[model samples]
Target: MSERQQAEAGRVRLASALSASGALTSEWVEAYQAVPRDWFVPDLIWPGRADGVRQEESAHRLADPARWWEAVYSDIPLTTQWDDGEHTGNGRGTTPTSSNSMPTMVFSMLAALNPQDGHRVLEIGTGTGWNAALLSHQVGDGNVVTVEVDQESAAAAKYRLAQAKCAPRIVVGDGAKGCPDGAPFDRVIATCSVRRVPYEWVAQARPGAVIVVPWAPEYGGEAVVRLTVGEDGTASGRFVGSSAFMRLRRQRAERPNSLAYLSGPWPADGVRSTTTLSPEDVGGWLAMFAVGARVPDAFPLVERYADGSYTLWLHDTAVTSWSTVDWEPGRTSYEVVQSGPRSLWDEVAAAHYWWRDQGHPGFERFGLTVTPEGETVWLDSPAT
Candidate 1:
C-alpha cells in the first residue's frame, strides 16, 4: 500500500485499539486521527517497547521505509532525539532524551486534561508539536502555548506545526517555568516526566484547572498524574496510569557510576546477606514503583551477563550507599552485598512487603500532593 494508505490505516488501527482500551475517547478521536503522528516524527527514530526502556536499534526512513512506517503506526513510542542531540549515527544513544510518546499515553493524558472548547492550554514539552497541534485543534490555535527546552527541538516542532496548518505559540525555554505570559491557563499538560510537579505550573494554571503530567521518583518507576489545581498554589490528584517518558531536562536525575559507591573491591567494607526474595521478585515496572515509593534517594541499575542472569545494583543518589543483588535463573534465594551508612537492599525489601501488605496497590491507588514546599506521595488518598 501507499504511504498515505499506510498512514490512514495506522490511524484507524490506533484509534480502534485506543478506543477498545478506553484511552482514545470520542471527544479526542478526531484530533488523534487528524494529527498524524508521523507528520511530526523525525525520519530517524528508535522504536521503543511498551514495557521496556531500551530501543531496538535505529530505523532510518531512507534506508528502511517499511520499518519506519510500521514503527510510526504502532502504538509504541519512538525515540526521536538521544543524549540531548549529542551522540549521533545509526546506533542508539546512552539515553533517550526526547520521543514521540506512545499514542495510548498521549491520548490518555489528553483525555485526563479534558480541556473545554475555548480553554487555554499550556504544554510543557513540544517534542514533535503533534500534542500541541492536537490541543490546538481541540481548543484554538491561539489558546495553546507550548514550551520546549531544546531550541533545535522547538524550532523543528514549530516547522511541523506550521506544516500541519496550525500555529500555536511555541516557547524555547525551560518547561518548568510554564510560560508566565500565558498565566492562568485553563489547563496544563507536560509531555515529559518530572521529579517534582513545578510550582510554576500550579501557579500559572487557573483555579480548578486540570494538570496532567508524568511524575517519577528518584528511586525508580513513573506514572501519569492527573492533578486538580487548588486556589492556594497547590495541586493534588491521583495517578491515572503507569507511564515511562523522557525526563524534563531541568529535573533529570544525576546517575553516577555504580563503581563510585564502592570504596574498594567487591564485598569490600560490605555486609553480606542472603534473602528468600529472589531478584526477579523486585523487578518489573509496578514493583519498582512500589519500592521507589518507600525507598528514597536510591535507584537500580542492571548489569546483564552473556547469560540471562544479571546483577541489580542499587545506588544512592548521594553516592554514599550501594548494594548488589545477584540473580540467577531458577534460584530460590539471592546473594546481596550492601555497604555504606544506608541499607539500600533492606529498604527495598521493606517497601516490597509494604506494597504487598497494601494489597499490591496499583498506580490508580496512589496519589500526589504538590505544594511549594515539596511533593508528598501517598497510597489511596492524600490524607494517608
Candidate 2:
C-alpha cells in the first residue's frame, strides 16, 4: 500500500480499537472513516512536545505517512504555537494556539454534541479545518460556518477544507461575536476552551439547541459542558468529561501574582466532604477558587506542573498571591483559612460542605445557562 494508504489503515485500526473499547461511538467511527485527517493537515506543521527544555521547538512535518498519521492520532496534545504569539518555530518557548485534538477527545465531544444530519451547526475555532471537515461530513457542508481569528490560519484552513472537498463556510474573524449571518444554529460547538460561555452563542442558537464547549471555573481545570439553550435564551448543562483544548483567541490574557504566596502544606486531617470526594479534588478546584476569589479576578490558574508544584500566577491584578500545598499521598487536606477580608478557603469549604450535604455528588450535574452578556449555573437537584 502507498504510505498514505498504509497510514490510513493504521489509523482505521486505531479507531477500531478505540471503538471496541467504547472510547468512541459508532457514529464517530463513521466520521473517522469518511474524513482523512492527513488530508487537512499541512504536509509540515509544528510537532507536539518540543525537543528540549528551552520551551521552544521548530515545526517538523515529514513526508512519511506512517509517522504523520501516528502524530495525528496520538493522544498527547500537539503544540500549535508558542511564546504567546511571538514565536512559531524553534528558539524560545511559546503558548499553543491550536491543535488537532486527540481522537478520543474529539469523539467524546462529537458524541456529546450528537448533531443530527441536516442540523445547522456553527463551529468556533477552525484550527486546520480537520474538525470542521468532520462536522461538515455529518451535516451538509453548506450548513456549517466556522470562525477562526488568525487570518493566516484561517486561509490555510480554508484551502485544506477545499482540498478535502468539505466546503464549510470558513470565516476569518473573532469567533466570540458568533456569526450573525448563521444565526439560530441547531448546534454550536467550540473547539477551544473559554472562561465563560458567550452570550452570543446562546443568542445565535435556536432555542433548545445544544451548545457544547469546554467550561472551566476561575481555575484551570476544564469540564466539557453541554447545555440546551432555553427559550429565554439561557443555556444549561453539566460537564460530561475532561479535556484540554487551546484557549479561545479572544480569551487570552495575562494575570500576574506574587510567587511567595504559592507554597503551603496540605491539611493533615483530610478534607471535609459534604459530598463523596477525592483529596485532590478538594485541593485542586476548591483551593483555586479560594485563592482567586480572595484575590478576585486576580489569581488565575496559570501553569500547573508535576513535582507537586502548581503556579497560580497573576499580575498586580493582585493575583500574585499564590498558595500551594504539598500533595500528600492518600491524604489531601487543607485548612484554607485566610486573615484578609476574604477567606478563600472558607468559601471553598462552604461549597464542599454544601455539596456534601446534598449527597456530595453531581459535580457532573452542574448545568449551564447562557444569556447574551453573562452565564450562570444551576444544580440539577436544587440541593447543591
Candidate 3:
C-alpha cells in the first residue's frame, strides 16, 4: 500500500460509521465501503482543528503520520483556504474553500441522503469530490451529476475523482442554479453549507424524491434539513441533524444582526432579550446560518500556547463597521441596534421569535419546500 493508503483512516472510521447508521440501507453501506475517502483528499491538506495548519506555513499531507492520520480520521473539519477567491490554500487569510468534512458527519449526511441504485442524484458544491464518489458508488457512476463553482478547485477535484475512478459528470457552474441540462434527478445532496434552499433544486427533483441541504435557523444555528419533494415540486422534512459545511462556491455569505432590535433602548436590556446565550455561541450560530452563513458543523474555543487565545470577532465585511463578542467572560459587550437597515442583531432576534412561535423546542420541528420559483420554510406543514 502507498504510504497514504497504509495510513487508512477509513478502516476504523467505516466500522464506526456502519454502526452509527444502524438502519442504513444495505446498498448504501456497501457503497460507503467501496469508496475510499483518502483517494478523494489530496496527499496534503489542512486539518480542521486548533490551527492544525502551520501558521503562514505549509505542511505535507503525508509527511506527518500522526497529524495526517488524525486529520484524515477525525470529525473536525480542516480549513481549505481563505478570502473566497483563488488565494493559495497555504493556510492563511479568511475564506475557507474545501475541506474533508469530519468522517462521521459525511456518513451522517450520506445516510440522510439515502441514495439507491438507479436513483439519479444531483450533488452541489463538489468540494473535494469525496461525497460525489461515495454517491456514485451507490447510484451508479453514470447516474451522478455534481457541480462546483470554483474553477481551480473543481479542476483539482476532477483530477482526484479520476484517480479514485469515480467520475460523476462534474459541471463547472454555480450550484445555486442546479445543473439544468441534467434535470429531474432522483436525489440531490449539497456538500457545501447553504442558507436558503436553492429554487433550482426544487425544479430538478423527481416527484417523491429527496433533496437534502443544510439551512441556518433563526435560533442562532444551522440544521441539516431533508425535504422530500412532492408531485408538485414542494418538499418538507425535519432537521436531520447539525453540520458545519462551507457555503456554495463563491457565494458571499453575510451576517445580519437581528438581535439588537429586541434589546430596545438599551444594549444591556438586549443582552437579556431571551435569546442571550453567550454571544460567541449565538453569533457563531448566526454567522453559520444567517449573515456569515458558514457551516453548522460547529467550532471550538481553545488556546494552544501562551497568548494563543482564539478571538472570534463579528464585524462588517469592510471592517469599517465592527463589533466585539469575545469567548472570554465579561470582557466584552455587544453593540445592538434595531431600527436601521444595518441593524444585524435585530434581524436575528426577529428570526428567534419566528422560530419560537412555531415551537421553541429545536430544529426537529422545522422543514422546507423548494420549487422552480422559490422556497418556503414552515413548521409542521410540509413544503409543496
Candidate 4:
C-alpha cells in the first residue's frame, strides 16, 4: 500500500484501539483527527514500547515509510531528540530528552485537564508541538502558552505548529519557571514529568484552576496527577493514572553512580545479612512507588552479570549510604549488604510491607498535596 494509504489505515486502527481503551474520548476525537501525529514527528524516530520504558530500532520515513507510519499511528511515544540534541544520527543516545508522548497518555492527560472552549492553558515541555497543537485545537490558539527549555526543540516545535496552523505562544526558557507573562491561566498541563510540582505553576494559576502533570518521585514509578489550585495558595489531587515521561529539564536530578558511594573495595566496612523478602518483590512499578513515597532520597539501580543473577543497588540521593541485594532464580532468601548511615534495604522492605498491608492500593488511591513548604503524598485523604 502507498504511504498515504498506510497513514490513513493506521490512524483509523489506532483511533479504534484508543477509543475502545477509553484513552481517546469523544471530546478530543475531532482534534485528534485534525492534527495528525506525523505532522509533528520527524523523519528519523525511535519508537518506544507500550510500557513506556524500552525503545525499538530507528524507523525512517524515507527508508522505511511503513515502519515509520506504523510507529507514528501506534499508541506509543516517539523519541525525537536525544541528550538535549547533542547526540546525532540514527543510533539511540545516552538519554531520550524529548519525545512525542504516547497517544494514550496524551489523550488521557487531556481528558484530565478537561479544558473548556476558551480556557487559557499553559503547557510545559513542548517536545514536538503535537500536544500544544492538540490543546490549541481544543481551546483556541491565542489562549494557549507553551514553554520549552530547549531552544532547538522550541524552534522545531514552532515550525511544526505553524505548518499545522497552530500558533500558541511559544516561549523558550526554564519550563519550571513557567510563563509568567501568561499568568493566572485557567488551566495548566505539562507533557514532561517533574519530581516536584514547581510552586511557580501554582502561583501562576488562578484560584480554582486545574493543573495536570506527570509527577514521579526520586526512586521510580510515575503517574499523572490532577491538582486543583486552592484559594489558599495550594494544589492537591489524586493520581489519575500511571505514566512514564521524560523528566522536565529543570527538575532533573544528578544521580551519582554506585562507585561514588563506596569507601573502599567490594563490601568494605559493610554489614551483610539475609532476608526472606525477595529483591523482586520491591521492583514492580507500583511497588517502587510505594517504597519511593515512604523511603525518601533513595533510588535503585540494577547491575546484571553474564549469568542470570543480578544485583539491585539502592543509593541515597545525599550520597551518604548504599545497599545491595543479590537476586537469583528460585531463591527463598536473598543476600544483602549495607554501608553508610542509612539502612536502605530495611526501609524499602518496611515500605513494601506497609503497601501490602494496605491491600496493594493502586495509583488512584494515592494523592499529593503541594504547599509552600513542600509536597506530601498521602493515601485516600491528605489528612492521613
Q: What Cα-based lDDT does every candidate model obtain?
A: 0.89, 0.65, 0.62, 0.93
Candidate 4 local distance difference test against the native: 0.93
User: Which candidate tops lDDT?
Assistant: 4
Worst 10 residues of 2 by lDDT: 49-58
* Candidate 1 backbone collisions, by pair: none
Question: Would you list the rank order by lDDT, best first?
Answer: 4, 1, 2, 3
Expressed as tens digits, the lDDT of each residue in 139-239 for candidate 2 is: 88988999998887788888888877789998888899899988879999999988787788888999879989986665445668888888886777777
- Tens digit of lDDT per residue, candidate 3, span 112-217? 8888779999999888888888888777889999998878778988898888788789998899899989988989898877756877788788888888887763
Residue-by-residue lDDT tens digits, candidate 1, 159-180: 9999999999989998988899
Residue 90 Cα positional deviation in candidate 3, in Å, after optimal superposition: 3.4
Determine the C-alpha RMSD for candidate 4 after optimal superposition of all C-alphas: 1.0
Angstrom error of the Cα, residue 172, model 1: value is: 0.2
The TM-score of predicted model 1 comes to 0.95
When sorted by TM-score, best at the front, the candidate numbers are: 4, 1, 2, 3
TM-score per candidate, chains pooled: 0.95, 0.78, 0.73, 0.98
- The segments of candidate 4 whose C-alpha lies over 4 angstroms from its true place after superposition are none
